[model samples]
Target: MNERNHISIREAIRGRITDGEWAPGAMMPGETDLAEEYGCSRTTVNRALQKLAEDGLIERKRRAGTRVREIPSRQAKFRIPILRHEIEAAGGAYSSRVAFRETLKAPGFIQSRLRLATGARVLRLHTVHLSDGQPYAFEDRWVNIKAAPGVVDAPFDIISANEWLVREVPYSSGDVRFSAMAAGQIEAQALATSLGAPLFTVERTTWLRDLYITTTKLCYRPGYHMRTEL
Candidate 1:
């Protein structure tokens, strides 16, 4: 069978749970019934059901049967790279400029976002993310040293903050809020564009286990967009 069969069966089970077709604590139809309905096989239904249970969307018992759980929609996220890595992958030159790094004493925004105790120190990194010889993104980030002290020593010459952090640091919390904002004179200058331009902004905050790690503001140039399917 094609790969889509697995996805079809998986989505079918989830659709029942979401539509309340399978009520919480109520047992689902047996594998035989599902196989007959989808015209697949008992094995296909079993594989799909096993994956659903592993994802915490259902519970299965030896004799009691499979039942829906009380969990909400399970979401899986990914860390998308800032720049196209084809250049780096094809042995072409990839470079980044770290314009500056400084310590900020808990600005009002980060103070509340990071849920700090006040007067906490954060590292501000201003960087121009680049690929080959072109600008990719403008990153203004604040890192909480309490969670990642080594981040201060981590290098950013050949890779981006997004790439390096995902490999080295393990964060527990991630919140992303997106908006369209007008670019100011400074943004236009760094991105090599005109003033008062439209930019897509992504505000991301992450917590490393229990300690706060970093908050970043990413600005994408004109004609930039991101898409995902539900």
Candidate 2:
């Protein structure tokens, strides 16, 4: 009936799978049957099932139908953290500053990363996140203007690009990488640390279906630790 109803159907179906009411390898009911049972349209049921498949909770095959996964993928799921929330959760005040913002042609590396055409225009932003008035992380980000045109007009000075993108953009798929890197001169200045100091770094790229959204590298100050749960 509405978007909320569709979301409820999705959660209901997910509960059945996670609660083992629909055992692993169990065939899901047909979309028509599910729609009738839920008193909704078949399109709504299909949307719910599609989301489950994308989450790896089930497998869907053409003509064969859908079934709960025997072994749900062990994919490491990570939520993109908002620096403000992270700082607040740790009992510190959070703040941010936009160091630089520009619109320019994609560099060679950026073109390769986002799979963009040569000379494609993009929005580049550099920002520093602070916790309790101290440097927390430095962010270097590139946005695909073709994918998110509004980014060019966003006021990064008022709201960090990290926060803005997370709030406004919805990505269908993404990847993340974690590593350690020695701070470069710019990063050193932003984080108030010496160059060559080891820093925890995270790189992320997100896409809305086939459209690349944005890619960012966040370098945390020395002694920063990251934790995630399975």
Candidate 3:
């Protein structure tokens, strides 16, 4: 999918953060300055910086202005790896709760994106991610049963599909993308935040050889930040 205007602004801001135009803990340009620089409105700059604040990539305050956060950025690289283990490595207590689960027909968009054949079935999972006791993320995922057959009847009460796949399934390659978006009502509720909250959106397409494995859309909390070092 093509990026929206806010996402384009997000990329530009992320680029500046990555390029050292704004150092850690350094204050950033005001909304008016940024708007003038980007040839957009203050609302657009607000939307972009709001997204960065939500992602925990930057800290914003009234009067004090926005500043590059002192946090490290070693968490944004995609290397076809495991999600559950990644969570564990971050030193946060990782847990998952199933919000919705079903075996359903893949939608036309999903079918085309996953390159599934007609009549193919997909196992769908709607999950909430928890770090310690706080809500962290909401996951909407679809797995190709033809690729991971056991998911058809898999029990998610004890383990998550991500954790299970990392332990049992081996994938060859994957593609991933990230963006910024306003959270819908339901997503905001599940994430324990307010409506229209800014969120970090991550989408991934994974394949095992030529077989499509799974695709997932992950919506992170208003304070979730991802960073990576070169």
> Top TM-score: which candidate number?
1
Tell me the whole-model lDDT of each prediction, alpha carbons only. Answer: 0.77, 0.89, 0.82
Which residue pairs show backbone clashes in model 3?
55-224, 73-227, 73-228, 74-227, 75-227
- Clashes per candidate, residues 3 or more apart or on different chains: 0, 0, 5
Give the alpha carbon lDDT tens digit for every residue of 105-204 in model 3: 8899889988999889999899898877678789889999888888877777688888776555664467888899899987988898888999999998
What are the runs in model 3 whose C-alpha is more than 4 Å off? 1-83
Which candidate model has the greater TM-score, 2 or 3? 2
Can you list the residue pairs that collide in candidate 2?
Answer: none
In candidate 2, position 159 carries an lDDT of 77
Model 3: ten consecutive residues of lowest lDDT: 72-81
CA lDDT, candidate 1, residue 71: 62
Error of 2 at 34 (Å): 25
Scored against the true structure, residue 103 in model 3 reaches a CA lDDT of 86
Give the TM-score comparing model 1 with the true structure, all chains together: 0.68
lDDT (tens digit, per residue) of candidate 1 on 21-70: 99877889888898899898787888888888877789889888888986
